[model samples]
Structures are given as structure tokens and as C-alpha cells.
Target chain A: MNSTIALFLLQDGVINGAIYALLGVTLVLIFAVTRVIFVPQGEFAAWGALTLASLESGATPGTALLLVVLGVSAAVVETIRERASMRPARLGVMAVRDVAMPIALLLIVSTIAPTKPALWLSVLLTLALVVPLGPLVYRLAFQPIADATVLTLFIAAIGVHFAMIGLGLIFFGAEGFRNEPFIAGVFPLGPLMFKGQSLVILAATAALLAALWFFFEHSMLGKALRATAINRLGARLVGIPTRATGRIAFALAAAIGALSGTLIGSLTTISYDSGFIISLKGFVAAIAAGLASYPVTVVAAIGVGVLESFAAFFASAYKEVIVFSLIIPLLIWRSLVTAHHDEEEE
Target chain B: MRQSIRIALLSGGVCLVGTTTLAQVNVGITVSQTGPAAALGIPQKNSVAQLPKEIAGQKVDYVVLDDATDPTKAVANARKMIAENKIDYLIGSSATPATMALVDVAAETKTPYCAMVPSKAVVDPVDEKRKWTFKAPQNDAIMAESLAEHMAANGVKSVAFLGFTDGYGQGWLEEVEKAMPAKGIKITAVERFQRTDTSVTGQVLKILASSPDAVLIAASGTVAVMPQKTIKEQGYNKPIYQTHGVGTMDFVRVGGKDVDGTVFPAGPVVVADLLPDSHPSKKVGLEYIKAYEANNKTPFAVFGAHLADCMSIAANSVKPALEKGKPGTAEFRSGLRDAIETTKELPATHGVYNYSPTDHAGLDNRSRVLIKIVNGKWTLLP
Candidate 1:
């Protein structure tokens, strides 16, 4: 292509790549700390985007009800798990944290979101409501199987993905929603015209990346999470709470998903089931990173996005094929390089 | 009381005359009520449910099944309806692929099927495999001609084509090319994408680079909104056109301001209120709108109206066949097929259908009306 066409393709690819990078980082985070692939990461984005759309339309989103259900179930599972040695004070605290807090948040969102708060504020509220779901899902579906084989954990993650997709359908219906862009205007940079939403996506990705860096570099909890990621058994023996670390990692992943969703909400139409495709692309990027190395995963995701953009310009019908074909070679390289190890029986 | 007595006497006389006479006309319908096409298929189901309960003094037993928009399931559903339910006629399948599969089942079983999809492949070529098949929706060829004419009239010299990479999209592309060349309109870009694709930015940018006078998107349902929104966001200020596949409330609701001024061709049901009173389809279209709104609590979708037209066609045949023989017999099925094949100037919803042995979808220009989306509402274009 000529210089101007190449420039536009680059712009489109970078904007899409930024979102994929956010998702790739989230996938890597969940896989590193927890042995699960976190297949439902895309659902968080769908829920986030759909919730924002509902709030914008001055309607109370069904995510409020989903939060309430997930919260109650999480609390119930926790209670049953700890019932044999339960302290009354700890039980009460757990109930307040798991059940009462989500219900209160749901009530607050229902009241404020319908009054049509500022778009940014509503988006923040949607993130708050959706981010907790990641940890709640972990407690309900994954924590009990924490000691299981990686294969079993992967199967459980797939089950969670299906359940979330069904729940998403129930909440959002089959109709698709498109959110209003957070920013409106276009800027010409050199030979390319840059969309305002594209800038928002870049800004959000950078901000979240910096925040994650600070959290991992300075904070005590962040250090604990790092320890858990490095060696779960060793960290547990040394007094790091592995369960809490899993929750923190899942929560961060969910936050990243919600942020990514909000950033891209206005750029495309989102339905209840749009998450799987978006997450699959991110998964490809994560695999390229070997499910580790946050910076590399981000760069790989942007590469996938730009490649897809150019592919679409050249062969639009085979663009998906071109993007997905990257995985075959990557998989081959990984199989050739990484050493295989069988899991030991506990 | 008089109507009830007349019906009772008529049934009593028929029963006294012969037990082998036609008892009921069973119609088996398969629609995509739960998948990607549910927005269109659900309304088709609702309209089929509203079919007249009795045809030709015989009770009509209708069984509706959800194919989930899958071609395999659609074939399975058709087989079940034919073998187990012993249906006399089959009406089915909102999406094109499912209808194509169901048509195969109908042909194999020697049972007549009325397909609700718009692809000309359903009834074209007039081979033995398609002898028992009929379609209710206007063919893609007719709609494409209308689009080409509308674009040409609006001074569009060149156009870009972006459509779904499926039967629906390919059908529109073929038909639009056939008509555009005749209208002296050059097609600048031809792009395709899947229905579930997350973005069409690359295709939209390419279309912009080509700088066509207009763009015609040949996608259906909610998926159509993506490219339209992308084109608008990218600041392509020119005429934009869509196909009849997008005549749904969800398209309007999802597209919002981005779809404003999008020109396309649609069936009369979408703008039933806008048709002049002297128009042949105005009254029938309004009647369908009333029945649909009463049941669905929304305006009638063109797919639903197509099914309504099919029901009318089926009803016209069943009344004549019941006078001849029983519904489940081969003779009765043949009679029904013949009746549907001979459909002539039958004024129902969508348009006045005129079917012949050579032309199964015998709709002319009367079946299509040029429409534009103005302020999130369908408006007729003179």
C-alpha cells in the first residue's frame, strides 16, 4: 500500500491492538497466579459494555441482578467451606463482605445509573459492579478445585465461560448495544485522521499498565501476589495467603477486562456473546507471550491487531483466517522449545 | 349462533358423507427462534401462530419448532414434522442456509415447503428438486434492481460493496452486479466480512480510499450496524445504502443516529402506513401490521410479513384441496403444490404474489419499495 493507506491501517491496527493488549495482559495475569485459563475474561467485557449501554439508556441493567446472585452464591459457598471450624464473628464479617456489600453496590448503581450520571461516572460504576464478579466466580467455581490437575482446572474454566455466556444472554437479550463514544472529535496526524475513541483506548491501556507496574513494584499485597505467581506452594508455606492472591489476581483481570470493554464500547456494536471472539484473539496474543511477560504480550497483541487491519485491507474475507493462522506456527515453536513435564500425583 | 350452527351442520354433513374425507390440514413450521437470526425468526413464528385456525371448513393443526438457526437442525426439524407429525405442508426457516437445508428435506420427502428466506436459490432453476419448494419473500434480484435504480437516480456514479461473507451476502453481490452495470454505475470496492467480526475498520478504510460515490452494505439484522457506524465515525460523508435484510426494529435501535439517511429497498410492511391508499399492498400490509402488533406488541417485521404471505398462499391451496381429498395423502399434497404454483395476483402482506410453474417467486417491482432511514424510522422514498 501507499504511505497514506499504510498510515490509516497502522492507526486502525494500533487502536484495536491496544484493547487486545489489555485483554492479553489480563489473560496472562489470571493464568500465572491461578492455574486456570480464565475463559470468561471476555464476558467481563461484554457485561461492562452492556451495562454501560443500559445505563446510558436510563435503564437499570440486569447485571445488578447478576451481581446479587453471584454475591449470594459466593457467600454461601464460603460459609459451607468454613462451616466445620466457623467462628461467629468471622462468619458475620464474611457475610457482610460478600453478600451485603454487593447488594448495597447493586442498590447504589440501580439508583444512580438510571438518573443518567455522567458517562465516565456510570462507566466507573459499571466497572465496580463487574470487577467483583471475577473474584466471586473464582470462589464459586475455581477455589474448590485449586488443588486439582491443570487439565481439570481448564475444564472448570470452560464450564464457567459457558455459564457466564448463558447468564450474559439472560441479562442482555440477543439484541446488540453500542455505547456512545467517551470522546468525540477527530485529529489529523500526518497523513492519518485519528479517532477520539482511539486515543481514549491508548490512554486507558497506558494508565492501567502504569498502575499495574506500580502495584507490582511497590505495594506489599503486590509483592505477595508476585510471590504467589512465582511459587504457589512456597509462598503459602512462607505465610503469603495464596487464596487471597488468587482473588486479587482475578479481580485485577476483571478490572482490566471492564476497562477494555469501556474503551472499545463505542467503537463497535457489542452483543451478549461478543466476548468469546475478542478473548480468543487475546488468547492468541497470550500464547505468543507463552502466558507470561506482560510487556511482550502487549506488543504481540498490537502486532496481531495491525496485521489483521492490513489483512482486511488486502483480503477482508480471509482476515480472520490470517490472524488465527499465526497460532499454528506459534504452537509449533512452543512445542519445540518448551520442555514437557507430567503432573505428579498429590 | 348462526355462524356456529352453519359450521356444525357443514361438519356434520361432511362426517355423515364419508370418514375418509379430509379431517385437518397440518402445517409444520421451523423458525430460528433462538440464535443470531432470532430477531427475524421469532416474528416469523409469531405470525405463523396467528394463521387462521381453520381453512376450507377443516381444522388446521400448526406445530412450530425452533431450528436455532442451524441448517442441520432445520433439516432434522423438517424431517420430524413430515414423518412424525404427518404435516400436510411445511413452512419454515428465516435464514437462507437453514431454508436451503429444509428445502432438501422437503424435496426428498416429496412434501411441499414454503421457504421464508429471500435468496433466489430456494426456487430458481425450476428443477425436480425444487418442484415442491416455494418462497414468500421477494427475491434478492428484485431488491438489488431497486437499489441500483435508486442509486443511479440519486446521481451515484460509483459505489462500494461491503457485505457478510455468507449466502445472503453473496446473493446480494451477484444480483447488485447484474443490475449496477446496466445502470452505468461502477462498483469500486468489493469487501466481505463475517457476521461475528468485531470490527470492519480495515474494510471501511479501504472503501474510503477508493472514494466511491456511495456504499451499499449487504448484511442483515444487527450485524449491519457495525459497518454503518464505522463509516460514519471515519467521516465518509456520502450516500449509504443497505439491503432488505436489515428491515428490523433491532437494526434501528442499535444503529441510532449512525443509520440516518441509509437508503434501501424493503417490503411494504415496514412502511405500511406510508403507502398511498390506492396502492394494492397498502390494505393487506396494514392488516398484517395490525395482527402482528396485536400479538408481538411491535411493528411487523418484513420476515413476519413474508410468513403471513406464505400462510395466505397455503390457505388458498388447502381450501381447494380439502374439497378433493384428505390432507395427508399424496394426491392432496400434489394438489396443494399445484395450487401454490398457480398463485396469481394474490394480495397479501409484503406484496401481491403471483406464482407460476416457471416463476415460483412471481413478485415484480410491486414487491419492493425504495426506503430510507430518516431519524431512526423507515420512510418511503418517491
Candidate 2:
């Protein structure tokens, strides 16, 4: 009974699972609000981590906390601007206004936001950077590219993906970057549990999802966002600023991506290259449901993570094969189910 | 250029007066200089780049080509070096398959191909079937033999072997088979999988099912790190043995604390004390380590540095004969072959690389080390 091997696999699942899940959540949210899947989500993670790596080193706990506060503030502002603008808020005029700044800020902040920020501050800074991203994406990349064609939008995202990776390599250099874990050391629980910085990833993910659920379900802004997502014309007819709402969702989703990135940076040894893999996994997770939405995406990420964990334990070599092989059959099954459901409804 | 041609015409006329002119030997060096392989390529490139500088006194003209690590590309590149570049002796094709591709090209050109394949595929493919190709670098079979010795010294008996199904993995597997039996060890279990497969817990469970004294792992990159974590959590008390690929800090960091107590069989770390100052290899090994660290802007890697070392030693053997005025493909090949075999005076970073036509990998049992990963640090085993 090599419990350590089992524990290792179990812990890996939980840690990577949380990161994937949050990223999947952001992708889902953006898709939900805008009806377009965003592929640039991993850039937010890389950007957030790079931001933290720059600022999080050698700071006092108090200073770190202060950085986190400032980060949260930035995130709020970003969210408002992005989510509000997505409703085609100035009748397509402010489409430029809605998404441009957040994207620029994400790029700039991650690369040059200064180092030596406090540890807690590093994490906060990352979250703050991401908070507005979800909403921002809806306004900038999705909205403009949305009308062109699906292929164009997908291509645009792939281009963005390449651009982001190239930028990280050029700016960060092709080296694995480091960040000290916010907490160190592990507490083992019998044969099956782990307590360390990695476990904290799950806690953070839960908090993010809970926040999203609250905002989307209970808040006034949330209801407006849902209206905008359902039908821009109807929302506008009902006096909702659909354009503005879409922008805000873009900002919010972008922010979530950034926060996930930051959390990932805090927990793992990240290279600038880590983003693409994260992006790949996140993108796959988002589309886990044929249509990108939260219900299927989060489940997909968790499912993949669990599979990987089990693979790591039993056949680390075969884990990826298991993941890819599982997807093909799943897609077929999903198509069959969708067709059956459609027939039943008809 | 025209003016130099006139001078060369005059020199040729005078040289015609001098013993009907001496023969010329063409030499070629192959290394990876670009693409993903550039991680090891640049060093290989530099070794080729520096060969001419070292051959300043020799009469040999040389060519350098990039392997790029693709077997198809390597063959094309090697063929171009032979047919187009007019090189007589061929060295390198970074990976085993790449080297194997060059075997036919080398045979057609009648050029002797010497290579550095840490993977076992290079030698296993050559056997009685091919005689023109020789290996210069350490092979996985030899490495397995080394590892088997390590296991025996540590009082290990029953063991489980886990490896990827690729050439690198299978090569080590074959070598372990060769060496383990002599050590009186029984391989209780053997597990295999494709490199890209992410989960290995089932194979690990199967390996652990045998209740062996140790587990041998031969893998590289992400493939190397995943299993250590599984082994850690599954609570295996017996030491896990890894090949050279896992002997790096990447394994320790990626494996995290999960690999803290594992043992990986390796050769000398070019940066470390294994090559003492008194050893003839100290200066050359240290210099390459320094140059690679400076060029790559980092510390040393045992694998990359060893490749760099091979390039230097190969150049040393070929360069002088190339200069002795018999600078043709045949003379250069014969020269390199003779120099490599007869060169007992020079020292190699790995060991005294007295390579011969019969002994492609000129190594003995003394050429290895066992390193342990303990508390996230690489330490030599006691």
C-alpha cells in the first residue's frame, strides 16, 4: 500500500483541477454572456503570474495584503467598464472603448507592474488584474470578431494565443519563472489526503465560483447581464444597456482568467510557456459541452483532472492517451444525446 | 576573389612541383543548431564551430550540418553534407533514429558514421546487420549495466522496470536486462506505455504488485516527473531508480518532494567534483561546462555537456589527420578512425574514450555514478 503514490496522484488532480476549473469557469462565463468562446484565457493566467513574480518577492505580509487590496479595486473598475460596454453600449461606437483598455492593461500590467510587492500583495495583484478580464473579452475580441464568421473568430483567438506565447518568450525569456508558495509545507492525512499550498488552489476556486454564482443569480447587475446575454434587442427594448452589459461581462471574465492565472502562479512553477498548455486545457474544458457554457466546462475540467490524477498513479505514460481517447467517445455520445433530445422536443 | 585565384594557380603550379601534391581529406560534423533540439543543438553546433579553430594547424577542410532531430530531416541534412557539402567523415544525428537514418546515407557514401546516442537504438540497429556505423557516446545498454552495478552494490535483488515504449525507454530496458541478470537480480515486473500518456498509476500499481526491492525508471521530460509523484503517494519504501534523464533539477522540482528520496543512475556531472582537478579531464570538462553555461546563460547539464565533450574529442581525432595534407574523404575517415582508436594520451570528460572500430563506445564499468534525490537536492549516493 504505497499511499504516497496515491497521495501524489490525488494532490496533483486537486491542484491542476482547480486551476483548470477556474479557467474553464471564466471561458464559460464569457461564452455564456457573449455566445462566443474566448481562447486567450491562458494569457491572463500567464500575465497574472508574471505580474505576481515581479511584485511578490520579499514583501512583508502587511504590504502584500495592501497590494491585494489595490488589486481588488482595479479588478472592480475593470469589471464595470467591460461588462457595461458589451451591450454594444454606444451602438457599436464604444466597442473600441470597451475592450481595448483592459487588453492593453493585461499585457502591460503583467510585464512591467514592478516587483518587490508583498506576497499577499502578489496574489491580490494577480486577482485584481484578472477581475476585469472576463467582461473585457466580450467587448473587444469577441464582439468585433463575432460578426465576421466562426472560423475568423477562432483564427483570431489562435493568433492571440501565438502572440501571447511569443510575447512571454520575448519579454520573459524562455526560462521557467519562479514564485514562492504563499504557504509552504504539507500536512498528510492518513493515506489519502494532502494539505499544502496546492490544496489551497481548490479553496480559491470555490470562492471564485461562489462569487460568480452570487453575482449572476442574485445581483441587479447580474440580472442585467443575463438579459443582455439572452437577447441584446430584447434587453435593449426592456431598457437594459445591452452593449454596456456585454462589455462588463468581458471585463469580468477577463478578470476571472487573470485571478486564475495569479492563483496558478502562486501555486506552481510557471514558465511563460505554461500559458499555452493551460489555454489548451482550458479551451478543451470550455468546449467540453458542444456549446461553451459553465455547466459542461467546469465538469469537463474536473473530469480531466481526475483522469490525469488516476493516470499519474497507475500509468503516467498513458494518462494523456486516456484523456484524448475519452474525448472522442464523449463527443460522439454528446452528439447522439443532443440529436435525441432535439428529436424528443420536436 | 579573382586575384586569389591567380595566386592559387601559381601555388598549384609550385605544389605540382612538390610531390605531385598531397591528398586532401574532407570532414563533416553534424549537430542540431535550431528548433526544439537546439536545447542540445547549440552545444553540438558550437563544438563543430570550434573544430576548425582547433584544427588551425591541420590541412583538413570541413563541413558542418544541422540534424534538427527529425529522422527524415537528419537523413536529408546528412545526405546534403555528403553529396553537396563534400564531407568525408560524418558525426552526430542527436537522437537515435536521426543517427540511424544517417546509417544508410553513410553506407552509400562509404563514409564511416560515428555518433553519440545515449539511447540504445543506435547500437541495437547496427549489430551484425551493419558494420560501417560506430557509436561514440555512451549507450543506454551500458548505462543499464552501470545501473545494474549500482543496484547490486546496494544489495537489491527483485526489481520492477517501468519505461516508455520509445527507443530511449526500450533501449534502457534492453540494457537493464543485459546487466541485471549478472547482478543476480530478478525483474519481477515490466511495464510499458507511450510517452504522451499522462496517467501511470495503473502501471505503477502493477509494478508495485510484484513487491520488488526497487523500481527502475527510464524516461525524459514530463514523462519522467509524473511517476515519481505517484510512487511517492503510493507509499513505496523501496528506492526508485531513474536513468540519466531524471538526474536533473527538473525532475526534483517537477516531481516536487515526491521524488525526494529517489536514486537516478548517471555519469559525472561536468560541473561537479566527480572530475577531480588531478584528473586529466578536469580542464576540458570544466571549460565546456563554463562555455555552455555562458552560452546558454545557465549552469551545466550532464547530457548537453557530454555531447559538447564528444564534439571536442571527435574534432581532436579528426583535425590533425585532416591537416596532414591527405585532406580527402578516405584519408580523413581513416585518420579520424585511427586517431580515435590510438589516442590514449588524451582524456575524455566521461572516461578515457579509447574508441576503436570494434569498440564504438569506448567505456568500461568505471564510467558511471549513482545520484540520489533527497529533500529536493541531488546528492551522490554513499
Give the alpha-carbon lDDT of every model. 0.85, 0.62
Residues A13-93 of candidate 2: C-alpha lDDT, one tens digit per residue: 767777788877777666656655567777777766765665654322221232333344444454566675545444343
List residue ranges in candidate 1 displaced over 4 A: A73-103, A343-346, B1-22, B233-235, B328-331
Best by lDDT: 1
- Residue A193 CA displacement from its true place in model 1, Å: 2.1
CAPRI classification of candidate 2: incorrect
* Top model number, TM-score: 1
Candidate 1 per-residue lDDT, tens place, A1-346, comes to 6887788888888888888888998898888888788888988888899988899988888888888899888877788888898899978887887888888987888888768989878888888888888888888999988988878999999999878876887788767888888888888887677878889889988999999989989999988988888888999999999998899999998888987887778887788888888888889999999887899899999999999999999999889899999999998998888886554453
Considering only N, C-alpha and C atoms within 3 Å, which residue pairs clash in candidate 1?
none
Which tens-of-lDDT digit does each residue in B214-263 have in candidate 1? 99999987779999988987788899999987887778898988899999
Candidate 2 lDDT over B64-163, as tens digits, reads 5665567887887677666554565677766667777777777677666767667545544444434456665566666787778788888999888888
Q: How good is the docking of model 2, as DockQ?
A: 0.15
